[model samples]
Target: MAKQFERIEPAHREMMGRQAIFFVGSSAGDSRVNISPRSTTHFHVLGDLSVAYLDLTGSGSETAAHAKAGGRATVMFCTFDSAPQILRLYGRPRIDFRGSEAYAAFLAEHYPNGEPVGARQVVTIDLDLVQTSCGFAVPLFEHVGERPVLDRWAEAKGEEGLVAYRREKNTVSIDGLPTGLDEA
Candidate 1:
């Protein structure tokens, strides 16, 4: 049976900390839904009811666009190695662009390890509910390590290059929704 909580408990937060990857699901009204796999050591629990992740530059900006359009998002973290379990955080998200005071403060507070390069925005989720379920069908696999391709690509792009790239590729969603990247 699945369990639901109003806020994330300590055990739930611990499970999130151990995960190497997570999925983000979002959609705009009357538009196609999007579910994308995100990888990075960039996820953080801000409090019992708040969580945030640094979103690196990517080809699609659906999540940010949908969230900006007042759509809810679901973030899922699954255990691939130890016991079989899955955790989901459902909430509304706000995107803070790089160079904003909010973004800088968020980086300083949660990502003390240092923010990742190519980080275009910080997606902060204000939790409405938390759920945990048995991951009976989620196959077990070992986490080797984060792939370096993204970091390498970002470094090669350089700061100005990344800004231009975002303007070119990350300004709109597949379904023609504005991602607010123009303001970034």
Candidate 2:
């Protein structure tokens, strides 16, 4: 059986905290649906109703374009090391383009070092509902580490190089929607 919550309860939040990786799902109407597996130290829960993640520049800006087009995003965290449960948060995210008010506020709170490299905007999700499902069949795995190459590459590139990479690779969704980013 599946359990649902109007907001994130204490136990549910703890379950999410223990997960090392989460999946982000987003799409535009009548366009390709994207489900991406991401592992980064970029997510934080502000309250029972809202969560935010710093958007990093990478190939295919599906989440940004989709949310910009008024699409909802669902973030799922499944326990694959110890417990057997899957927690999903259904919400509509508001994108915070860099230099926007929301982005400034969020960065003020969480990113004192400035946005993460290969940076773009931020995605703040206002939770509508949270659901937890049984993960009896989900395989368990050991927690290893996040990818080191990209951060190292971005670091080596320095600030200007990172921006250049974003313009080259993260400017648009695969569907060609504007990702609210420019090279310079």
Candidate 3:
């Protein structure tokens, strides 16, 4: 069975803090939906009804594109090494570009180590519903460390390289929707 809530409770926030990876799903109108797995230590509980994460430069900017186009997004956190539970947050999301004030504010408030090397934007979600389900079928995986490949790639790219790469690869979503990355 599943349980639903109007806002995140304290226990739910604690569980979310323990999650190592989360999935972000989004769709804009009739465009193709995107579900991307993100592994980061840069998420924060803004409030009982709000959460945000730093968005790193990636091969696709579908989430950003969808959010910019007024799409709804769902963030899911599942237990892979502990209790069998899956929590889903349904909300309206927004993308704050790298140079924006919102991006800088998030960096200053949540990321103690400062902005991540490959950070491109901030994805903030204003939650309308939070659901939890028994994830009895989810497989258990031993905890490991974060992958260094993305950080290494971002360092190699530098600022200019990252911007160029975004232009070449992240400008448009798979369905040809502008991601707003080009403007950023």
- Misplaced by over 4 Å in model 2 are 182-184
**Predicted model with the maximum lDDT:** 3
Give stretches of model 3 more than 4 Å off: none
| Winner of 2 and 3 under TM-score | 3
Give the Cα RMSD of candidate 1: 1.3
Q: What is each predicted model's overall lDDT from 0 to 1? A: 0.89, 0.82, 0.90
State model 3's lDDT: 0.90
Model 1 poorest 10 in a row by lDDT? 36-45
Off by over 4 Å in 1: 112-114
